[model samples]
Target chain A: MIKLKILLNKLTPGDTLTFFATREQVDNTCAPFSSNGYQVAWDQEAENRYLVRISK
Target chain B: MEDSANYSSTFFFCTPLSHERIIWCTECIASGAGITPEQGRIFTVFLTGDALFSFVDATSRESWNALSKVPSVQIVADGDELRLHGLCVSVARAAPGICITERGGGTLFWEQLISHLAAEWKGTKKAAFLLCHPPYMSRIPVHMLRFLSGAYAAGLSPELYAYLDGLHNIHNGQRPSEFENIGRAIATLARKSGESGKDPWFAACSRCATARGYFQMNPGTGYCEPASSIDEITIRPLKEILSRFPGFYPILSHTSGGIVNPDRSRDQDTRPRLIIFITNPPYGTEWTFGGLSLALATAMEGIPTTVVFIEHGVYSLYGTHEVPPNDKVFNVQEMVAATLDIPSLCYLVHAPSLERRGIGVEEHLIGIREVQNNDLAQILWDHDYSATRILFF
Candidate 1:
């Protein structure tokens, strides 16, 4: 449980953030930026953790 | 708390500070179960500098109907979106690596590596993405290699210390005849009881050439069996552990930059081994068959033999992989499976390589283990001496 904006503050374009979350949460988390111009991709990790990459 | 909508940009990949996890949230218009405004979050993972990847649960999520249709995708650069998606895992770059093999404990290894990195990268902005496998263990033998191997794949990519298996000292080079001689001598005593004793296994295998005593239990079956050779004793459980967590082998030591340059001469072993680097798919059956056939012949010589899979070669282990018709080597996969029974024969794959292609260890054949890509260099270093040639296909 973290504030997604704080991560956006530290991340330069091309940085990636990896964590475990459900499909619904992930879509919600990315929805705001995806509607904008942020370029992101999704990946899967062990234990169902999702790897999301953003390059905006 | 800042509103989630306040953040403007979304990207792929980030580097989290030590002891901390980070996230980035954004909104989209995708539909799925429990969907809330189609939110997306970015999390941290492996690579050089920072890592970038893409996925949509990467699993066959029944609820993720929209994502399930795509199955695989990679989001590396900015301005990239899921043109089509279900799931994917990307290969991040190699990081710094260090190993404390059999000689020193983990503490010393880490301290030394940190010091060395500090010294070497003194004016550079390079961060430490270290792979650590010290000679100590909480779980004893099992998880130690995986911890090191997985960490290596996570970004560590340098060799920090020398490691020895100590298998040489465990066995004193006793050939099968000596084993037989000793067994026969012991059997003579059993005659006093008027009961014939069974021959102690390992009377003449090179694997026992230097073993004091070597034995192992079968994994598929619980039966205790004589170790075919000395190396066999160490090999059996090592393979079993890898099978239990097959990806650890690949994750520890597999990478493109990690491979020995084919143009350069390979390292030599006092005891020459048949080391085959498999680098293709079944569709390229000629190369695959050639390597597999040579591997079988080499194993017959009682030489320490191994098959290393790189790139798409990792997929060859898939249970569903079928030999192409008109193949020179019929049932190549079966041949590989049969070869596992020989203790000296080894199989290694790269975990990230498989993950990059959305493959899992459970989907592969039994007995094969995955190591990190970088481990290949160390394997060549540890096994192959300078001035030798390793057959590559």
Candidate 2:
């Protein structure tokens, strides 16, 4: 939750952001962000990284 | 091979007769002269026996007649061409007044004849032309002989002709051997120009050629090499993308002699870090999967990672679409999607299929924004999330 606060302060519209979290969090976490009008993109696990592209 | 002693000009011609019999006669003539076959330059011509009578030049005609009369030789001529089947029967086809005009002396004509013969005729294998000339000489005009000799070589089949045509088109009038090395490499890769297959690197190279005009096609070599600035763009993008994530250490491992390893550094404080990998592995080689596996292992060691599998289809990820009766196709997206519920994890899936359906980076992030503002985001905010990492491949 503290990190989310920091991320919210750091993030803005049109900025590119990345995140590292377990598979479970990524799937559930994005729905709320998406319903609020932010853009999001993710790729399947390539090597060890799941790529997500976000826009607000 | 004594280099000095073997330095003699020779010519060759194709005949309907067997090459083994002609070589036997050549050895006999050499023996009769009290010398070995290697001592002098000899030109052998191959043609049918019935074609010998068309010769009108008295000297060549007489020589052909006399050679045919020899007990060891057999003459067969068809139309304007003649084949002498015996030792040293060097006449291919005889035509009356078919003289080659030269600005220089008549010796130049003989030299030209020698050059043409040596370059065009060596033997026939698999019913197709097999021309082998000394490496010291340029092997031009061999392309012409390939067509002429095709009838005796392999039934003059259309497939053979098409193969020759492809060779000609690729070379742009250059000799076949000019691109021999690269041609062999391409063949080894089981690829040809404009053909599509599972090999992403080949596809990438072809794409690079088509889009940027950076790769030059060497038909004889059966390979392509970078020729322009555009050629470097594909590799350069990876470097640029990786440079953006300063917090994540990069590690590049060289899997082959031609590829350079990228830079990777590690720091203990950045326990959760993002990593990106981008590479086009060689096609049809075992290392393609091995390379992917290694990249995966590196990511699982606590460093978040993303890999771009360029030009390859999803089939490579899961062996087949019709999953076995007992098991299901492993959906990487579903697993990553499940991670949304986890407090400490974030997952994103960017696939061409998904992108085409209007689910792209921007759209995905919008979802992230919504999730962060809702009750889920409130819950995480109340609990205080840990440090974050971002991985790109």
Candidate 3:
């Protein structure tokens, strides 16, 4: 989604952003970020929730 | 800002802006960036793919007129190509944005983009693409080939990452009747890249290849070896994709369905992560398996990815699967098992879905977390942050 891009525009390299998502959303959206040179890491926070932390 | 300094080139593909969004896009590009028409910035907009329709839309007339007032603005379209295709479209004004109506009009837009990229590159320009389908699944692969050929002809190197079923594109001995041989085409492209002195980086996901029988485990070394494939297609571990192209560069992902365009933003920090919901069992349709391949590829690429089994999708998590001996069948369960240990890949099953189907957690393979309905809803809500996306298979 472009929302991440808009948020990204506000930050610079070395900045870290963290967000929560469902398993489904994470699988669908993470590739673009990781592929684009962002460092993406995630862990299960609950039964269906995950915390996705990304760094440029 | 002088008009000369205001000149900016923005490339747009696939559908022209409608009247509603034209003002915003133009304003953002022209004035919002601290440059104005008075300062003498020439803003160029190149649009292709069904952009012809913008010419006839009644609402677009006003926007075109408004944009025309900005003397520094120049709008260019693939006018000749569209017209030759019987689109019969034209720009509303001769002044503001000139329609490229000459025979070379079609290629002129791409040439300019290529030139701009080359200038920026100061060397060879490269565009990386992700292919996610087999040869004849759809015309998307063909479309990718066409785009790549154009770029290659323009002296820009093109990179391809074949994931999921797209690994089939590199399978050796592919025979298709009366269609472009995608395998051979890619091989040819790779060869051309070498001939042109550009590094050819065409890779397929090893895990995907293994699952599809293209990579087999060697009994001696316990390492998987590429079983058979066309020349120039290198089978690498999925993780290699993350490091293949460093920094943020646009990687166009093509599936049989369509292109998954990345966010046009230049920042890597804000790119979106992906989630795929497998809501059906295997063997019914390709969605379940396709979703699995996508999940594995993304996760292996180091993207935080999750595959959730919800609704009927929970069925996929249940039971160990067995393939008949000497039968050519993809064992979905084995594929899931192989992915269980991959870092960044999580598997979840909706508890309510399993209960509704009279299935128990004990019946399913270990490692898959089971979530209740409320938790699932909350999970979806939490994921609403930023641009995180959810897809159903």
Model 3 docking grade = incorrect
Question: Evaluated with lDDT, which candidate comes out highest?
Answer: 3
Go through the candidates in order and give each one's DockQ. Answer: 0.01, 0.03, 0.03
How would the candidate models be sorted by DockQ, starting from the highest? Answer: 2, 3, 1
lDDT of 2 at B271: 32
Per-residue lDDT of B1-393 in model 1, one digit per residue for the tens? 112221111111222111111110110111111133222211111111111122222321122223222212112221111111211112111111111112233233223323332332222121111111111211111122322323233233221110122122223344444223222222232232223222111112112222323444456554334453332123232212112211111111111111112212221222334456676775554556555644543453345667877566766776565556875435546556545655556888766567767876444365577765345534543322211123444
Q: lDDT tens string, model 3, A1-56?
A: 23453454455788888898756456645545676556878999976679988887
Candidate 3, residue B330: CA error in Å? Answer: 19
Error of 1 at B142 (Å): 48
Top of the candidates by DockQ? 2
Instruction: Give the TM-scores of the predictions, in the order they appear.
Output: 0.28, 0.19, 0.47
Interface CA RMSD of each prediction in angstroms: 24.6, 16.2, 14.6
lDDT of 2: 0.29
Off by over 4 Å in 1: A1-56, B1-269, B322-329, B362-364, B383-388
True contacts kept of 3: 0.00
Ranked candidates, highest lDDT first: 3, 1, 2
